[model samples]
Target: MPRVSQAHLDARRQQIVDAARARFASHGFAHTSMADIIAESGLSNGAIYRYFTSKEQIVIAVCEQGTEALPKALTPEAVAGFLEYVRARARENRHAQLVAQIYAEAAVSPPLAAVVQRQLAAMRAAVAELVPESRRADAAAIAEAFVALCASYSQQLAIRGDLDPAPFTAALMAIIRE
Candidate 1:
């Protein structure tokens, strides 16, 4: 019997996820099939299925990829860093087209809707922590506004291939300063 290390398992899973992300980004969630991902990964059905049973699960993983670009802390500096990160991604047209695709699909998919709701809540909580205690009542709304703005910026990149971002950055800083 051979013992496979945990790192090996993680790497294998990530390999599948990376392939799924590329396929989904290039062709979108609705258009990309599991077979496409399997082919893209150059792995067999059993190998890819061993990691993700369905294309929806793989889409969720792709959604999870962008979460890291969000701020880890509630500090103003971290928020600024997050804005810059979005700006950089927008300039690149971003790997996050998959995220926008998820949003579009979430309207019809309950599982995806729930995933998005959970992530949005997590983001709101993180942003709320940055506000003063007395003003926290508006934190959730502000967080949603920030997310929506970022989403629009990301979507624009898909068409234009570049976003000026100065206006969006000013608006994001205003949200934080408020």
Candidate 2:
């Protein structure tokens, strides 16, 4: 057996994470198994475990990726940009469904719930920094409102197949500006 170099190991870990994202986005965190990830990534069991201890860890990583990957600024222009991003992602379908599934799972799963809450708090803190000084006190509230609006938009897209986001974003910004 040959030894894998540090760089090779990091690259392999990234491969596993990428595979997990696709698997979780398609099959969902609950239904996706380690073997499914193994098949998706073409990585051995040991290689997979070398990067993550369990499915929950992989899921947390995916959720972190999703949260951290979102645009940070909350300005009107940024909001519009994010709306477009969300709309485009909605068109993709799979990843949006997976995110919704993760939200549902987080509601019942205590461990996952913690991960979700933690990531949301981090997102709020980041947004808080970007918020104007006058709005600092409302940063957490604004963050909550922003998350709720996006979730609602995602649900609407899933249920109604309607992609129009302008009205929703406008209304949300109005509320935030109040």
lDDT of 1: 0.75
Worst 10 residues of 1 by lDDT: 87-96
Please name the candidate that would achieve the greatest TM-score relative to the true structure: 1
Q: lDDT at 23 for candidate 1?
A: 82
Clash list (residue pairs), candidate 1: none
- Candidate 1, residue 1: lDDT: 100
Q: Residue 64: error of model 1 in Å? A: 2.7
Q: 1-178 in candidate 2: lDDT tens per residue?
A: 9987999987887898889888887777778999999999998999899889998888777776676345566677787788778778767745567678778888887888888888877766676676667777897887777777777887677556657778877976775687
Instruction: Report the error of model 2 at residue 45, Å.
Output: 2.3
TM-score of every candidate relative to the true structure:
0.83, 0.82
